[model samples]
Target: MLKLDHIVKDFGNHHGLRDVSVEFPANQTTVIVGPSGSGKTTLLRTIDFLEIPDSGRYQFDDLDYDLSKPLTKQEVLAARRKLGIVFQSYNLFPHLNVLANITEGPVQVLGKNKQEAEAEAHDLLKKVGLDDKADVYPDQLSGGQQQRIAIARMVAMAPEYMLFDEPTSALDPELEVEVLKVILELAKMKNSIVIVTHNMDFARGVADKIVFVEDGQIAYQGDPTTFFNEPNDRIKAFLAAGQFNVK
Candidate 1:
């Protein structure tokens, strides 16, 4: 459902990504794994349009995204609505409670009435196993709970695709499992999901395909089981070194 061609991004002296190209199928989970500084997060941001590419072609459905063209107000809004992003850090509002945080996008962006938004938020919270914490503030919730709330918040927006940037990176081991459960459940759904993570287990368990990035380029892309079980010498060496701490 999404295609990127020759995507390249550079930050002056730093190379974020180079000649990266890949396709993400609809209703399937695709995991991008790499060591730090390998451009995993940058690729996600570029796909979500948060980071403009220096040279590339990004096609979503029939629309071609031009990195150089300034986004119109409507175009920007529409493009953003097509995908939801969850950061490594829980980006919840300090002031908003779980319910409010989840409903804010629907109420404001989609222009749904507060009552309608709340109903949708309630259902989404329940889906993420956060229904009981709807009234709780983010600070009051554990990291896992907060992350689930973040997931609910994004799901409430009903985006066409979801981009998760190491959703479990900041959590404790216990909390990581809690967040992973929600993600695993999401992976079962009929929505496209692209995750940037070093968690090898999670990728093997949930990903339909895996893409390994190294030195700002796609080093490997194939069936997760095949890649994980019979990785090439370079990948095997990298995995052996535990360079990215894949666990």
Candidate 2:
């Protein structure tokens, strides 16, 4: 469903991604694993059009985005509608209550009426197990609750592809599982998902494909089973350095 060809992004003298190429199938979960500065987040952001590449091409279904050309505002918005990106931070609006925050996108982007958006927001809240917190403000909820609400807000937009950048990194151990449950459930759905995560167990359990990125390039890409069980020396070294226990 998604393809990146020779994608390269440079931030001054540092390279964010170099000659990165990969294809993600429809309705499958792909987990990108790497240490810090490994370009995992950059890859996700590029796909979401949050970071435009200096060169190369990105394709989603029939749509083609040439990074060499300047991106039009309308094109960027159109591309974003099909994808939802959850940042490391919850990025929820502090001023808006849970319901209002969740419904804003639909009301503004989708042009749904306020009443209709609110109704949809309620259903999304229930889906993420946050129906009771709909009336609560973001500050009133726990970190996990806020993250789940963030997920619900994204789901409300009905994105065809979801990008998760270290979804559980900001949470405590106990809180992490709560957010992971929602993400795991989303993985089971028939939609494309790209998750950049350090949670080895979650990646092993939910990913159809595991991509190990290092130094701004794909070091290894394969089935999760093989990746966990029979990784190469480079991968083993990386896993060890990251203190990722594969069990």
CA-lDDT, candidates in order:
0.86, 0.89
Question: What ranges in model 1 sit over 4 Å off?
Answer: 68-75, 243-247
Clashes of each: 0, 0
Q: Write the per-residue lDDT of candidate 1 for residues 131-221, one digit (tens) a residue.
A: 8988889999998888888888898888899999999999988999999989999999757999998777788899999999988899998
- Candidate 2 lDDT over 177-217, as tens digits, reads 99999999988875688999998889988999998888999
Return the top candidate by lDDT.
Answer: 2
lDDT of 1 at 247: 33
Alpha-carbon lDDT of model 1: 0.86
- What's the CA error at residue 84 for candidate 1, in Å? 0.2
Q: TM-scores for all candidates?
A: 0.94, 0.95
Clashing pairs in 2: none
lDDT for residue 36 in candidate 2, whole number 0-100: 89
